[model samples]
Target: MTTPHHNTAELAKLARVLDRQDPADLDFLATLPPAALRRFRDQITDLIAERESRRMQRIGAAAKLIPAPIAAKITEAAFGPVLAAAIAGSVDPARAVAIASALSPSFLADATVTLDPRRATALIAEVPDHMAAATARELIARGDYLTMGRLAGSVPDRVLRAALPHAADIDLLHVGYYLEDTDAADRLLAIVTDRVPGMLRATATENKWSEAITLLDLLGPTERSHLGNVVAHQDPEILDALLTAVTDLDAWDTLLPVAAGMEPSALQRLAERPIMQDPAVLTGIADLALTQNLWLDLLPLAQHLTPTQLHIVAARISAEPDDALTALIEQAHTANHWDTLIPVALALDEPARRRFAALPVMHRPDTLSAAVTTAATHNLWSAALPLVDVLPPHTHDLLATTIATLSTPDFHAALTAAPAAGSTTTLIRIVLRQDPTARAHSLTLLAESDDLESLVTSFATTDPEIWKSLAALNSELPPRLRTLLAAQAASCGHSDIAEALAT
Candidate 1:
């Protein structure tokens, strides 16, 4: 047999191991403690129970407030079970009743043994109570329709009929039937051809909408019409059920008013449901949204809609053609959204083109170049030609060169149509700067013109031989122009060219 001292040492070591294990393992280890370990185990139990009690109290206090921050903190503490226990244990029946009704099943499971029939009954009265079949039936028969209906709303008929005598509250009965059985919901709806509007209104609040809709389905044409008016005028929650009722009966007239009154967010949610997956509903929402100028409201629904539905939404609000084009240009310039600008430019009308031309050059050169090039590419030459002067400097040069190359016939005709002086001299000089030619006529053109001095200065260094030829050929040109050419030659250290000019 193990000695007492030896067992105490072993138990002490085991307790230390248990401390490292989970809380549940510690409890299991407590049952196996040696005689000497009892004191340590008792201390651990007392400390844990006290900590749990404190945690429960904190949660109980947080449940009283509905503020988002407080609720979030309470949820973070994982206090649902503790809160449920407090509710089940409370001596004050009213507070206990409210807590039991609101606490979810997962929460109730966490509560200590305080979960009982009275608490479950109170929960059934106010909220959907998840309970044993017998308990739910007992609660229903007690004329506690709130708890009975809510519980029956969730459970099936074998549980529901056990307590209630008759299906007097047809809405509640339907809820109970649906809970007990879906066929029951259908059967109850079939018999109730014309329900009292008050029952429908109350059921609407309880979110027993399937029952309300079943009643509307049984209504005759005239009865349905009057019911639609009643549904249209109810509070938002009730009106929401009415929308379902209309959808059930395919009552478009009734759907109109309730859908119109719903908040945009709520309407958008309804529009996306499979049951409400109708083009007309989407169109109605779009029309309402457009009238209110709810740009943001239509955006989320865009992905859910058919192409035709999208177009209807797009049409409701008129786009300013000019503004759209202007925005396209800005986006293209800033974000390099080049593709966005192409269709915009192509679609621009004559008035729009004129408007574009009237815009500042510095603001939209990229767009203007694209527009002009596209016009030219499509052989809108008349439109393209005039845009050259307004294009940016490099763009103007490129388009002009392209036009001169491709439309040589038009180019030559244009030259004769509007003759310009000094243009040839300027072009030849510019060409010479790039690819210098010392031909006699080119030199003569350079030598004879008083305006060509800058060009002469530019070229003298390039072809000192050419400047010497020009100065020798023309004596009457400005002396300064001749002298400057000679100096340019000397600066280039071409003594022979300089001496030839001097002679």
Candidate 2:
């Protein structure tokens, strides 16, 4: 979780557990659950600790007896950082501090990496604040957030306060990730709380969302939501960059949760971003959400989209295989996200909409009822009615029952509030089927559409598949409108509609 593996958060955590070792091991590690991976990490760390202790037992006697100055000289000349680390833990605590203080901060910092604090607890505790502070600076210079993070618990608070300001916001951001110890991570970040905004701006500027998401995950929810809001206000280019990184890394697990905590307007901005609407990005997001079961996180985002973006989402979803679409419906039903789900299904061209409505899975009464509930809650008659036109009889009956439950005033108000004009004919059919008493009222409301002529004309002039749709509703149209729709249907060679209207 501390590193940017440009993969799912699970694999990234696996990388963290493995300390970025053996790229090939990931294939094997991927098969294990998180708890198993944690156990494996603990065993590996323990094995290293035991082996390190056995490797250095004799060095303690030599260090205490040989004198500090001589040892420092030998350290610089013979023992490198790794061996020095192993020896430091075994020596008498005072002697260890003396030997460490005599070395340059650069060398101490290098050795500090492997100086298992669990073993060198005394030496780490006894080390002077100045020496620790100096070494922190050296580690930061080396871009070694890993060592700083691992030993943060052992570092004096005063030393950390002094040393952290020298680090870049990005460095602070990354250090937060490397701290596996929750207390240590919180202590380290608490010092730089004021720097969070700067940290985010730098992340956006650097397009480091991969690393940023890793850190955000570790910060837990409250902090993540705060940062998520800040990120929402970033410049358009930042979102563009985010889209690039998220898709490339497939880090949706982390990013989508952060996105969920954003303000409604912020979520709306993000949903409408041009790059976010890219068909490839949209399809990839849906497919990834489906594959990873991230629908719980992704569905809230759909609630923020405007109709324009709904069209984009609908177009992207229309191409999914029936099985894929069915899976999406299943997920939405599980999440109770059908309010948002219906808009995209309805926004599809009539052909795709018909195909989607015919999916056998749509017949589940529970699924249709949940969708109707969401649609009613959101007053999505503009969207829900169009898709209802293609639904099976049972679903139609369900929708009619829902309509029957609404008062005539509420029903007419819902019709009056149609958010778009595309669903006009479908709305008229439903009005006649379920509440013929509101016929004059709904027709009067729809009669004012400035685009009505062209809208109906296109039914015949455009795709033949769409022209045939009017035939189903023609008989429900009033005398003049029914005649006009029949003529339009016959002009498009759909005489079945003309004959039905004629009858």
Candidate 3:
């Protein structure tokens, strides 16, 4: 795949092949994609391999006259590692394995660096376990991870298991980072499962963050989560360093799934980073979460965000296309993340809240109903009510009908919550649009509750047809409460309420 991650790994490979320490040095090749660069690297490797094969063929013909032992000495003494590795492919497999067995571990270790297992697969796999271990120890001592990483894929499991202990933690990671094939990387991780924590500590302590993150990108989700959890439990300073590494590398795509799998305490610690607090950074984090379908997994950490951060995030969320916003809300409903989502919605100031409420999804009866029901269940009425105030009248009608379905105590609690939630006028407008029976039920509860003055004071604030709304309003209210509504409306300059009530 041509993922940004793939390009990075490809660049690492290309850099190794060219012996270029800095990617910037290869800027002339920048326009070539990773796959093409890979092909180009292969072409160069092939030309060298083909030349070596011709040389090996010449040596193999000469070796036919001698037994394996004499050939091993002559080859080691004359041609050394580079030619010994090359000629093994042209030599017969049994002859090659026999000659390899007689070779010194030091000779073999140096030869392995020049070896292409593809050229002599049998010769490499047939290397005895003891020989493999000694060669591995030599390579580890030399810090020649590139060779170990290559041979890691070709060597037998017994050889790998034996070799694993000699390498230090960072050395193991260097091999892991250089591993070209994903299955090989997976196999390496599997063999050293018990050592992942130590490897992670070494990555943090030694500033090998790029290699650590590259290994993380190479892993599948399950493995990434496991590794991520191990990394998460490291010191907060270490986690902070990892975050800095991710930012430097632009590896949020790699970090998202890992973050999703972290335990709550670890997530809170991650959230405490100043880098995580920036609005633009949090917005990008959220965008990636939704893009990756990790909102459910990662949003639990949002409870730790600051209010200012939440507001800015909500503003960006409100600016998303309607279809996308609707899908996100539906996902939120499915995931029951209202505790996290509600605060984000409420943090939107009035103008943004109006835009959010006016969305096409907000107009859908089912969407509004879920919002109300979820708010109640999540005890987010304090947040949901302000949003309710700005919704179109059609949504208000559905919301009113939804409220009517509530049992008496729930209804009374909602009535009582409206004023404290700063949505008393919104509640009055919803009541104005309710059915006669629900309107009567609401007024009865309103009269019995301590919120009547709030009700009377806010009733005149509902939009459109002030006199007609007064008619619907006065008819359902009790005689005593009717007097209060009329007086409050007139006192607020809507003399029509008093004139109509006077008749």
Candidate 4:
């Protein structure tokens, strides 16, 4: 339609116009004839492709000469996706790693995700420790948990150690769960211990415990035990959450053994949690302890529980068939766990408490002393009073003498509990041997009895000093009761006690 030179000039002008305006602003181009528009679009596409190829060539050439620091700056200035593609396609892996190291860890980590997978793997494997840690934090912040999992096994131990402090528990758990190179994971966790000793516990508690349980299998026994120690040191709420997860998931088999390995103090802390007071939970733990021969391990921990918690354990254990109860008691005795068992015994229902008191093992003097001391110290006189009847006469005499050693409040508590437990004879014998200060309280208790006359007569004959002590209490005693005691002492031919009582 036009001469060739004129058409050439028109096409050149159109190209210049397209360049001056945005190539994307194609409204005017669309108004041109179809043939003209097609040629124009084709020319634009070819020119763009040629320019991009030349730019990449320059970048590749410049990359070989620039030091990593300068190269990092250049790459950071370039569009992120284009820079990623250029590095992946044209840069040597070693050089790429050097430049990546020089870049901001966060920026490089974002760029890394856009890189081809093979390139990313190669580059990540070579990142220096500091940069690797920075990248790990960036990945966590971005919630790129899957990528973190993929990279963790390939990262060095020092890098992981550096990074763990910055990691969130959720991300760490996610990575730990999926990391395939267990040996690498193990080394990584070990390094993590140096920086964040509680990482395993925090991660396990922050995530679904099933994932944490699966990750535990990757660890050796020592590491797992260390992790248990860490878990035991966590807050009670965290431990409560862990127990709830274990219960909800029915993962006791997986968890109890770990608990069994905890240090005594830590295990004691776990035992003292109110959550451990749940009857089902306590029963489950008890069954596990019995089956695993973990009574020695568990009893010390149980010793730290609150009385209410001990009561729950005692009730549950006592309700077990007689054989199980027998096994529990026998194991506790053999383990020298009386300090642990005494509280549980004191918390038992009357029938159960009496049943435990009747066990032949309770008669051993050392065992009896430990039980009586613990019960008295904790004010479990109700549990202790009943045991008096089961003691052999010599043990009874020993216990009567021991009761005399109690502090004032404990002494009064024992005397008050004795009559209710039908151990009045034991109390009477104990009173007969007590010092004046103790005998005064005993006299007050005896004065409440209808056999006040017989009690006074027996006391005057058995321990003449008790009458001297009772006479000292005349000012404090009710007049009528004092008169009765004096009349009884006089009739028994102890006019000395009668005369003192009348004063």
Q: What is model 3's C-alpha RMSD?
A: 5.8
RMSD of 4: 20.8
Ranking by lDDT: 3, 2, 4, 1
- Report the candidate with higher lDDT, 1 versus 4: 4
**In candidate 1, residue 378 scores what lDDT?**
46
Candidate 4 wrongly placed segments (more than 4 Å): 1-128, 131-161, 175-207, 213-241, 252-279, 296-312, 319-327, 330-339, 376-379, 389-394, 401-425, 429-503
Checking candidate 3 for backbone clashes, the offending pairs are none
Better of 2 and 3 by lDDT: 3
Stretches of candidate 3 exceeding 4 Å from the true structure: 1-27, 30-32, 46-71, 86-98, 117-128, 153-159, 248-253, 278-303, 315-341, 365-379, 400-419, 424-503
TM-score of each: 0.22, 0.65, 0.72, 0.47
Cα displacement (angstroms), candidate 3, residue 428, comes to 5.9
**Candidate 4 per-residue lDDT over residues 107-185, each given as its tens digit:** 8677654343433466556667777778778888887654565456666666677777787656677667655445756
lDDT of 2 by residue, 326-421 (tens): 988888788677877877777788889888999988877777777666767777766776677678655655565566566545565455544354
Q: List the residue pairs that clash in candidate 1.
A: 124-147, 125-146, 125-147, 155-179, 155-180, 156-179, 156-180, 157-180
* 317-369 per-residue lDDT for model 3 (tens digits): 77777777778777877776767777777887787777777778677777677
- lDDT value, residue 328 of candidate 3: 78
| lDDT by residue for model 1 (267-344), tens | 555544544445566555545544444323334334344445554444432233556435435644554333323323
Report the Cα lDDT for residue 340, model 3.
Answer: 73
**What TM-score should be assigned to candidate 2?**
0.65
- RMSD to the true structure for each prediction, in A, is 26.4, 8.3, 5.8, 20.8
